[model samples]
Target chain A: MSSEPRIFDPDEHDDVHLETELPEAELSDEAWETAALPDDLLLLGDQLRCDATRLHESHRADRLQHELLRPERAQRAETLVPARGISAWLPLLWLLPVVLITAALVSNGQPTVPRIPASPAVAVTPSVTPQAEYSPQVYSVSLPAETPSQHGPSAAELDALLDLMQNETASVAVSL
Target chain B: MKICGLDVEKLTSLYFDRIHRAALLMSGNAWDADDLAQEVFLIVANDPTKFEGRSSHYTYLYGILLNLERRLRRKRRMHQEKTEKLAQRQDGPTAAVAADVPVVSEEWKRSLWSVAAELPDGQRQAIVLRFGEELPYQEIADILGCPLGTVKSRIFHGLGTLRKLVAESPGQLREIPRELGDAQSDVI
Candidate 1:
């Protein structure tokens, strides 16, 4: 319990007070040494590490090579099968020909068969500018007399029709 | 067509290794580090042809790595932080301690790692760079994307904590080096 400082005056052979502050465990003459790695051991460890790394790299390379060489799945054309029966074919068959004929005729400066006007086929209007009730181009087909007579009004009615047609033509011109 | 193209490639390869090693040390795991390295290289390899070689390739790559590391660190931090916050909401103070140590071991290395792991993420990162990788303070700072002073502070504080933990164990403190011992004593 003494607080007095230790003296190291002349003729004093007493040892130095190294134990005062130094922790007992730390005062040992021997320094703490990390386990010395043996030369062979060190070499072996280096070789092992190198081998491990090489193996890892090889695995990585193998995976990459596999990926590089793996055959890609070919993209196939998806063929469509319609759910409905021949009805679907009917529309396509009718539409394709009409569209192609229209396209070809237009391209070649040729006209297709005219559409029929929507009237009873008896009361053909007599307008000179062709006042077709349904289609503007329908009346231009100019049916043959035999065909018209066969399909159209009787001869007795034709005279009456002719007179009526003349009156209608005159009225249409006046209106224009 | 730029720089000593071959030398630049070599320099870049070296830079990549160093940066990857640094990243690995900081992250403490291989997979994360590899991903981080890959990301870093993706940036560097972009227009390697554009490199003017005005600066050392290591310097440029380090700059890019540091930038990316900081960003990734921030993202990881955000994720960990969110998890911590959610855990806290559920369980309070224990959540913090629970999230701290994910592994347990009795080995000295494990003990040291656990103690190091318990430190603030920044201090832990600084110690990994300085002690685990033996990087200079400036480089440590650069890698951690922090100021030199901050890096020093982290290393000093981390070492101080580690020494105290070591001192508390078993018998009286052993003969730690004067240099290392002094660093610990100076702080406390």
Candidate 2:
């Protein structure tokens, strides 16, 4: 009932105001001692202390990579089991507008560059430039056709096909 | 590669576990804690200028970490809000999603740390730094960028809240009240 500043009396100390007069150094000590937590809180503290380490052991770089890459792993997991119903294609959903716009643009006008009439003085010839640099490198390799599987062409047919392929490649190179 | 005059790998190695531990205590999930820890370092690695030698590297990283924890908790709360029945939505697919997280006990999920995690960020950080990390109150004050008295008060109230929560629940504490979760968000 008194509004006056009360004097510190050790004898009248209750748990609530137990540390009001204590120094900062003794506040935690005095408070924790008197306001002692139950065994459960102590147990929790012990578990935390044991678990909360300040420094980790020397981890192998790869091991660190493995741990550090957990977010990537989560992303990969999300990717692995992509959204089943409609969500799976959510990423590609944006492409819908893109495709629609592309189609619209294509249909609106050809997607080709606008052809400019050549100046007569420039003499733009129709002769090939022999684009060896841009020609596709055709590697000659044996195909499954050489082995006559039930579903495969015979070796003779394969040789004919190879010859035809060579002819086509040469023609394509010459065209380039 | 070095940032803020410390090697990135060396920085990662030095405080990685400690940050993870602090984060784990703050977030009651290993997966989230691991992510938060990685993010703290990522931010440091990305922007070294944030560390202007004003505070120790640990404290600077901790400040970044706490900011991230706030953001993460906000995101989770949003997700939790969306999942309204987050309590009933335990185990199963969540476990599958957290496949790489170290196996933590379900019992721990319902422990004091879980409830402590629900404490206002200030109190939770104070409690974790004080009791979990066993740092001196002065150091906690430094890490939290608050007065020593504020740090002490936070830890004290944090523990008191923990006690009240335990007493109210009377068993493995689960169902955290929204009021309790929002009771304190600052270093009051």
Candidate 3:
């Protein structure tokens, strides 16, 4: 069988009078043949039609069975009732997290603990002298005379100590 | 005379089978068909004024069903694409490569219905409405919201594809005599 579709020209039927005017019985044999599709194609169409009809019938039977088994009005009404106990609150449980998040967001905008002003730099300077003995003496001895005044030994005092150490070293060398 | 401002009993008696059958063909499955059929009726029942009497009630119902079917198909396609993309991402580019597998002629031999199912939405719908529902071209055009010429073209191309698929399994053609008899009885 050729796979090509036999095209029906609409123009061929244009000259024919209205369909109601000319019933099948009134048509000539040649005219009827021309109007109808090929026998082979019709057979194919019939086969498809049969399959579709069977499918539809089966579906209808299934639908009828389903409808027959469907829950009655009373059962449906029962389902609509609110569930008991904790299950009843299940719907409202979703709001907990949302409320908590909103509360946290609102609270975060304000400081919880009072922020104390940092201690003044002058107060911190007085505590530094007690720890000065642990400081490297080289840095203190190298301080220039023009260094800024602070709570540390003066450059003149550092020079006098250096002179006394030199004199003691020279006397020990002469005695040896 | 009416249950919901429309003749519920009359509508059920006259159009229920055809509408449900159309739904089945459009959906290609029983579950979706049942849902689509009920939805179509529900829409009609909810607002009888929407009918407008412009065309046959069947056409109006079919129009609604077809529109719903299109949306379902689009959603399904999008889901499939998403799944494919995820698979490619997990398995690398090699997973995305199109398989070179050939169409199995034996599958078409087993069931022509499967081949019909594989057709594009337009072609499948046209074929179903034309052959399954036995609707006239003009009515199909109305339900599909397309021109008469478009309906004819869809059916033509759809049938041609079916014929080509069937031709793939020549051995199956030999079995047509028995099948044809069964088909004739079922169709009539």
| Top candidate when judged by DockQ against the true structure | 3
Give candidate 3 misplaced runs (Cα > 4 Å).
A1-39, A60-176, B1-13, B92-111, B167-188
Per-prediction DockQ, in order? 0.01, 0.05, 0.10
User: What digit string (tens of lDDT, one per residue) describes model 2 on residues B29-111?
Assistant: 56777889999999988877767787778888888888899887787676655454453476335543344333443545555
lDDT of each: 0.52, 0.66, 0.65
Candidate 2 local lDDT, A111-156, one digit each (tens): 4667787867765678888766786879998766566447567677
Ranking by TM-score: 3, 2, 1
Top lDDT hit: 2
lDDT tens readout by residue for model 1, A5-97: 988665443222221222322322111001222233222223323433443354356558767766542212213443445564676776887
Q: Pick the candidate with the highest TM-score.
A: 3
Per-residue accuracy of model 3 over A1-176 as CA lDDT, tens digit each: 89999587666554222232334334543343235434454566778877776765666676788788676755777789855567766989899999999888877897666789898666444444564457555644565578665766567766776787776765432211
lDDT comparison, 2 vs 3, better candidate: 2
Which of candidates 1 and 3 is the stronger one according to TM-score?
3
* Residue B23 error, candidate 1, Å: 2.0
